[model samples]
Target: MSNPKPRIALIGECMIELQQRADGSLLQSFGGDTLNTAVYLSRALGDSGAVDYVTALGDDSFSDAMCERWAEENIGLQRVQRLPGRLPGLYCIQTDAAGERRFLYWRNEAAVRECFTTPAAGPILAALPDYDVLYFSGVTLAVLGEQGRGKLLETLVEARRRGAQVVFDNNFRPRLWASIEAARVAYRSVLPYVELALLTVEDEQALFGHADSEAVFAAYAQLGTPEVVLKRGAEACLIRCDGQSYEVPAVRVEHVVDTTAAGDSFSAAYLASRLLGGSPVEAAEAGHRLASRVIQVPGALIPKD
Candidate 1:
């Protein structure tokens, strides 16, 4: 019989998103890095695997709506925590003529910042190791702060010891970090426990000061990470697995709508393919295909059909 479907838990924040229209109107939606990945992963997996989102939200209407949306997408919500009075963070997305997007965030005081600090967090953190895979990102590290990050580190140690695969996406947003050095230190602390690292070369260069993709791969090699995938925009994505390397070119899109969640969509499809036994090259190709479709749409998500 085939192996049982893997259970994956993605940890991070989901924010209220406002997309700017050409006519200067705002379209409201919900999105975040790990949340976007969770949604896409669930869609890609269908009934083959399970995807759970682990985060703290508020008891506000927006948080309620976010959970409702996730349920509609078939993402598991047992790990979500709701705190009274606090609300989800908000952000606005603006896209240029080239389909490139910029964001303005009001997430500094989001409820998820205290995700690992509250009394309810102990049980949640303890349960993370039971999942087949645990996923988080640089934004998760930044938003969690020092104290929360310490708790996350402890949980990661336990989770790795329990044989759960830890996956990280180095989605580096310099503005979220206190300083370059602090970010470096936090990233280094988490690297030793990661099983698979999904990285963006540009983010690597900005965060760890790596010269290029080779430098980034070399750095990960030294960390003894077993599998690594490096995504380069509109170029071939490189993968290092089982001591072999493969390069997969991205699918070209004729018309780009919005570039929001492009990397998240790629990461989601890549991880979904990997979990479902796709080869590294196949997984990379899958990532590119999904990302190309996502960029042709307006928001972080597209129609299910």
Candidate 2:
């Protein structure tokens, strides 16, 4: 008999997004790292697996619109929290002539910061361990603060104990933490529980100062993570799976439009491929295929076909 559809939950913040055009006009929308993954994962998986976005949002219109968009993608919304009187975070993306983008954030008072602190969070925390796969990123850890990070770590422990596969992405943003030491402490604490790690070579170098991809792979090896993928922009991605390593070249894209959500999109396709029984090489190819198409678009989410 075929296996039942795996229940996958992606935990992170979804912010109100603004895209700054070259003529200085701002287009409003919504996107986040994990939210990008959730959307693309839903698109790639279709009805093959269950995908959910777990985060808190305000009762405001922006939050309402974010919900509508996710639901339109067929992503699960049962665990989403609507906090009273709070607001979703906002960010603006500016792209250079080369299509490389930078962000300016005004997210200090976002509702997701209180995601794990509210009284309503108790049941949400309790329900997390029942998932078949739990995915989160370094941004998820950074935004959670110390207490929330501790709580999330504890939940990861319990979830793994219940046989959930823990997937982590090291999408490290230096501006999010008080100190590199603090980020290191938090990342180290969660590393052992991770079964699959999706790492960006540059982010790993920025955070832990891994001199090269070898050092990054060696570190994850020490942590005993069974699967690891190192993504390098416009270069080959390195993968270690099932006690062997594979180097897969990225799909070439001419005239890159926006590099936003490139890694997020890759993670979505990679995880979807793996969950659907594709081999590691096949999964990396799937990741490259999706991400190549994403960067040629304008926003974190491209228009559905």
Candidate 3:
């Protein structure tokens, strides 16, 4: 008989998002890097695999709406923990004339900061090894403080030993980290256990100070990861897998609206395609195709239609 479909758990936080217009009005929504990946990955995988979101949130109306929305997307919510008297983080995005965006955050006391430190985290961490795949991004590491990161690293090591594939996306946002050295240490700690890495070239450069794609690729190669995919916006994504390298071109978009989740969406499709048995080249193509469409929309998520 064929093997059972794999189960994937993406760990991170989902926050309340506000987009500030030139007129000084704010449009409200929900967005987080790993959450964006979870939603897109679930949509890309459909019923082929089980996709679950693992996070902590407050028992508020906004949190309720977020959970309701995830349910409608067919994402599993069994690992979500509700904390009383706490609420999700909030941030406002302001875009320039060139569509470049800046974010102002109000998330220091967010409930998710305590996610991996809560009593409920013990069972969740213990059960993580049972999944076929575990995915997270740099933002996940940033939110989970040093102690929490140590715990998460231990869980990742155990999960890998149990044959779970650990997929990581390097979605680096410098302001989220206390210091560049701290971020470097955290990333380096997790690199050895990662099976597949989906990296954005720009973010890699910003985080690690790599001069170019070759430098980025060289750095990951030193980590001994077998599969690495590097995404370069509006250009080809470079892939190195199974002793072969491939360049997959991105689909050109005429008009770009919001590039908020372009990398997140790409990571989702790439991982989804691989989980479905697609080769690295095919997976890269799928990622680019999805991201091309995502950049045309105004928010992190686009309408299913």
Candidate 4:
């Protein structure tokens, strides 16, 4: 008999994105870290596993377009809750003359902020333990508030105990958290339950003030996670698995049109390859292949064709 396909659920928000151009105009699209990862994971896995996006959105035109886009990508949207009279968040990206990007947000009242507090959230939380894999990120944790984080931590523990793998991405954004201490506490609470961790070395250093890669590796090793992948933009990635370490070089891109979802896409492809029974080295290669292509495009998702 063939083995059953794994079910993976990614929990996070996707907002309306405005990419500012040099001509003073904005190109509109939709993206978020976990959402980007979800789309890429679904694409990489194809029919090998089921991929779902777990979040709340408003019943607005933008929400409709977002759902349509996700559907076109063959991602499962059953876990996405639509809230009445609430709208999705919006943000604009501004790039300097040198092409470095900065983000301006207007999302304080977005619908996803209430995603885990509503009556419908009870079922969603309960359903989480049943999935083969549950993936979330630091941004997801920061946006969920203290009460929601506690509930989520409890759910993760239960899900792990019941044989589900919990994957975490450390997408640390300092502006999102009130203080460094709070982010540290929240991250520490989730570390013990994480089976696989996708970390960006720069973000990790900013959050924990790690002196170097060895310090970062030592910290994650103490957490007792079986696998850890450290991403360094434009450089090689570091992988630590089963007490063995490997340095995987990133695929070089001739031109980088945009770096919006580079790390997120890499994490998605890496995890998808692993779920399909590929080795860590093979998964890392797959990740680099995808991310190398992603950075060459102008947005979070590149055209599959």
What does each candidate score in C-alpha RMSD? 1.3, 1.3, 1.7, 1.7
- Model 4, span 210-289: residue lDDT tens: 98888888998888989999998789999998999999999987777788898999999999989988889899999999
Tell me how candidate 4 scores on lDDT: 0.90
lDDT of 1: 0.92
Instruction: Write one digit per residue (lDDT tens) for candidate 1, span 197-219.
Output: 99988899998789988898899
From the highest TM-score down, the ranking of the candidates is 2, 1, 4, 3
lDDT of each: 0.92, 0.92, 0.89, 0.90
Whole-model lDDT, model 2: 0.92
Candidate 3 C-alpha lDDT tens digits along 142-258: 998898898899999999999898999988889999899999999999999998998888888888899998898898888888898888888898998866999998998888877
Enumerate residue pairs that collide in model 2.
none
Q: Which scores better on TM-score, 1 or 4?
A: 1
Q: List candidate 4 segments past 4 Å from native.
A: 1-3, 96-99
Q: Could you tally the backbone clashes for each prediction?
A: 0, 0, 0, 0
Question: What is model 2's C-alpha RMSD?
Answer: 1.3
The most accurate candidate by lDDT is: 2
